[model samples]
Target: MPFPSRPVAKPQLRAHSKYPSIPSPSATYLVPNTSDPVGASLGGVRVVNEGLVGIGRLSGENVDKFGETQGAASGLYITDWAYASGQFSGKFNVLPDRGYGDGSSNYAARLHEVNFTFTPYYGTSVVPQTQVQATYVDSTKFTYQDGATVKFTTGLNPDTVGGVVGARTGSLFGQTVGLATAANGPDGAQESLLSFDAESVHLFPDGSGYVSDEYGTYIARFDATKKITGLTQLPGAAQPNRPANTPNFDSFTAPTTGRRNNQGLEGMSVTPDGARLFALLQSATVQDTNGGQQQTRNHARLFVYDIAGANRENPVAVGEYIVRLPQIDLNSDGSGLDGTAAQSEIIALGPDSFLMLPRDGNGLGKGTTVPILFKSVQLVDFASASNILGQFDNVGQAVSPAGVLTPGVNAAATAEVINMLQQDDLAKFGMNTTIPANSNTLNEKIEGMALVPDLSTEQPNDFFLFVANDNDFQSSDVKMLNAAGQVVSRGDGRLNAGITNDAMYYVWRLTIDAGAKFFRMDVADAP
Candidate 1:
């Protein structure tokens, strides 16, 4: 689509630099566990400086009359990278964000543990591999580790589980407990979520790291064995099915209740020194809007936590900032033809600065191009931004239209980093091939991101940017629906009858002034 109106001559403002000296940026690409139907097992696992790990037992779906095959598991994606002293080791880990592989409805929504392995060769390369490994989902079931084993009904508030008989109610659940399966739609046994919508996992050196989820609070810590040893609940964040009349805690609800269903906390990161932890909401909180689909709010929240040797209960939010994500360019009917951009992942670069991946659903552009809409990464800083948490508390803002980011008001500062969808950029990353467009379309949910040192180069600032996508286990034509399960529209035209979104990975050379601070150490020395 050419510019309708004559556009002013634009000049590149970036200061050209010679960095990210890696000849090849990507390696062994993996697929999600297509075996499970309901739950697309833990989609992605990334432990900085540790060996890459991913495993799947997929049952390929008949995607195209010819092209790639699709998986039947919940359409989800998980990605992880392997590093040593902050350098790529030619392997990475991949997983599907699946629930407790229990053959129940929860399979689609309630995922538990994920089994992944180090992929040395994408097609047939065997550099150094982290054989099939597992990460067990921690127990959020209060007293019992297996939390989703109870029976419940559909459409009912999911929080009721905590108050149920034999549950870890009241005192056991921090004086309150919410439901993790509210968005799951119906009743299910063994449907409990270990980490609600586990989005990204950042493991520490000592066989322990934090896993961030879009729901079930914001973040939690898992032991080397995969047991969730600690948890981090975002302010105003809570589960569903709480006792009737109970207050809504998950503040980022879609209906302006707490958090829009499924849009809770999505991104999390820790400093290279492991002294600080960072997390952000995928979008505004429910107190702000009903859902990101409403397209009314773009002011997302970024919270920082202190994790200097602190276990599960130790990491607490020390500061908060606003990240106004890119707004969608909608049609009169509020639909995006090209796509809509939303913040999916973030990585801490330095003190109050970081890089963000705000992508759109339009997929990569044609002729080996960038996504027409949200497909690039942004560099942002919260150092000079004001903490408006008090402002929202003083006034009913950030939830509805009561108050928004007023012009002239200083918030987080952001700048364009890279247009990942560009075919040229793909080549620059050593892919050397354009993302072929067709019935087997590759437009995907760009969800995972990680930065590592480019040890292969001379510049100390040289590093690798790992970007990943979650196919949501989508196989052919998918019906994009609203909260009501009503068929709202169809997805990628390529999926009219195309390929399965093979959980994919792409790496790029990134020259960051401050090299990535990764905890690349043996598990025994994490502390």
Candidate 2:
């Protein structure tokens, strides 16, 4: 019983005083005011004009300097910005996990630097030639920060530092444990000590940052040179600890207690002041899920770390809270619950509040006919939530034993900020929430999110939230590469097929309440 599809309507183009003609592939829509349901739920925050103000895109078949296919971004961060000489220009970075190999071949984790200029149109009376223009800077493969490239392997290795071949260790970051094998690894692929599966990335003012991983559910710090500097491991409860003293990182095999395979830290953020770091799991850990039931993964964990001052290298877990993720209807019908909508990324508004994107696995790139139900950027507040740091940071401890929070434990407060499924908003972009989604439809996996100030003197509180997608390297005409940087064929042989999913980006303009204490850029030109 899927939801009925809405009638496809032509885009309503409007001219603005700033430009005589409307820009192609970009539009300025009405924002949601206090009276709107989404705005009302914000309590005090506001969304300027219908939410979305601009959109940009990158081709799926785009390749890097290494001649390897550039996959969709799993994370995003604005490294620098400026508003001088009557123009707005900025530089940012996008994180792409193990290349087109998925979990089979050994692909290196990398980052793509992009430079762009933005010509914002706040109202219908003001249009510009180009709403948002972006250009590729270059791509860099992550290293041990000691001259060694990190590989994305599914095989396991023993814990030993450098100088030993195949030793499971990082350069400056020493010995690693809980080595496990993924169920989908090739029959025989080389194992390496420098394995990684990058998900979310957050940068500090100095260009150093942390990238959350899916394999170890670990967060590794990187220097300005994009090299690994330090590592922060999660508590035992968040790791996949196998029974019989053996490692089992395979997604198909259930660990005695720990994170489910592939369901590791997907979203992470650091406070603007660089005093704290927040890491969120994609969903519930193995133990938190009621007997491996995916539907019960609604109870996810949010870990807060003290990374201020001396704690930068050795971050301490200060607080852990339960974030009840939303459950959606798998059938798209008004029926029983399906499963938890996995969260992809998060951004800190303050030490006590942040923005989270939780979405379903449907839409354009999924190759499914189901209609998308839920995909949104939500505001989460942990001001009054109970801290379960010490008590639940171990094996056998469950925050919600029966699919609900245990007594005395309080979950974080969440309010919808931007619902990507809104028919009116998607319509303006030539997108929709229809069954058997088309190329023009909204793509699945809106994972990356970054916030920047609007830099307007009159509206000091306004900001732009950039949302991006993870295309899964579904380009029909892209070359696949192996660990040795050699071109290879995809196992499925759909390389030159008809399927093509581009890396999509959507920009939403929002107005935050001054009292909310949202992070603001300190650039000289910033209002």
Candidate 3:
């Protein structure tokens, strides 16, 4: 129904050629407007060529459809994504189905869909080309509170259905014992279910979507055949609770105050006139960090919702800000600020702006040789921020307790739009940003982001973006499934013995500066 104004289709030109031809736009991939640091701190925002046009790849032993190992094994891959533009067939991308799976158990939180095709070369010569291409196509899973689709168990157990108990409770890293759901017996009597750790996603305009959860940092609302109709619950300062309001979907305990056990709600985004819905925080919470330092978790927290009426699944938490992130120098030399480049995905672009990303967790499937010093994307801007929704939605309310910011707050305004570790724009596309990393380097979770428009009737205001990657599934060729979706194992146990990370993608382009009031998203071009 909305968001996808064209420019994605391209790939079908055959005539005595073996692909790789496309090319045209290149003014040497244009990008220097004095290298916009978000147009020198938001004075209208122009990028138009961090332009690496397109590149995509999926293999790492692809598989999906219960044969398991889709983007390689171990927490599977693509931790967040969404794209659309496929009415009669051709441009897709959804990815979320792989939450508590690879670390074992707690399965059932699905969302697969992939179809992709893009092409785009607009070259000034970027050697390694792929121009986007996906294909897995179908999966839906999620249904909880006994609508069926059960199993959920990662350990702390308390889900029991036909034997009573059921409200929630399931852990993955927060082990309390040697559990593989403890052989499914005692522990409130088994049956099990409810653990979901999806991460982030947002799609709407009739196909219904919105899935954010690092386990009970919950935001569910599925439909379009993906089931789970509605649930929002975030605020209790982003819930983990411990023993206070009780939730705690343990990523290894340490809760007592919300989100920071594996930092919840990774990043979600809606607005392109879908009327707001943001939700970030892949860091800072647990009473807004200070001693849990990593540069004090760089403040984080974003949230904002008001899903444009008809009770879009009860989403109404107006605003809340605090965006700091970006701390780096984890021994990259001048040594001091030890990490917190946190933030992983987001895109919005109006209703107060968006586009986050933030990175660095070392490169190529993280067997870490360090060196990735901050990836980019940035440009937050809650129009002069400082909302703190109803004074920090509870749980020892902190907004930055000791690490600062809470003296009349303010926060938001970031800026840096796209530098994804440039390195000659990723060595003109053959990737590899350096560090001992090889297999084409560049990937230690760039998460997922989307954007679209470049329907270009002479560049209406450009746009494209895209980005992606979350290959934590570190594949060495994989297949694994067992929790009874069957296919039990085929590889991935050399402990990433020779690293494999495929599923990457990056597009970039950008423009939007006709004085920037940006909105564009009712989509309609392709015909």
Candidate No. with top TM-score:
2
Superposed by TM-score, candidate 2 places the C-alpha of residue 10 at a distance from the truth, in angstroms, of 28
Write one digit per residue (lDDT tens) for candidate 1, span 1-527. 11112222322222342222211111110111111111000101111211122222232233221122222222122333333332234323332343211111122222223333322222223222122233332222111243444322111223333435212223212424334332222221234333245566676545456766553444756666555555666664323322332444332322334444555566777766777788877766545543344454466777788777543456866777777676655321234332125577788766677777776544422223332343656666776777655445322245234226554546676655565534322332233222344422334566767565433233344445656666554544433212232322234423323544444544444445543334222111111
Best first by lDDT, ranked: 2, 3, 1
User: CA lDDT of 440 in candidate 3?
Assistant: 81
What are the per-residue Cα lDDT tens digits for candidate 2 across 346-465? 998777778889888877777766667778777777777899998887655677875767889988877666778766566665667766766667777789998887653434565788
For candidate 1, give the lDDT: 0.43
Could you tell which candidate, 1 or 3, scores higher by TM-score? 1
For candidate 3, the 10 contiguous residues with the lowest summed lDDT are: 23-32
**Candidate 3 lDDT for residue 218:** 68
* Runs in model 2 lying further than 4 Å from the true structure: 1-37, 40-50, 84-87, 122-130, 145-191, 244-246, 483-485, 491-497, 514-518
Error of 1 at 401 (Å): 4.3
Runs of candidate 1 with Cα error greater than 4 angstroms are 1-91, 98-104, 108-177, 180-195, 237-253, 289-293, 331-340, 364-372, 389-403, 406-409, 426-440, 476-495, 515-527
Which pairs of residues collide in candidate 2? 16-125, 17-125, 30-49, 30-50, 31-48, 31-49, 31-50
Candidate 3's C-alpha lDDT?
Answer: 0.60
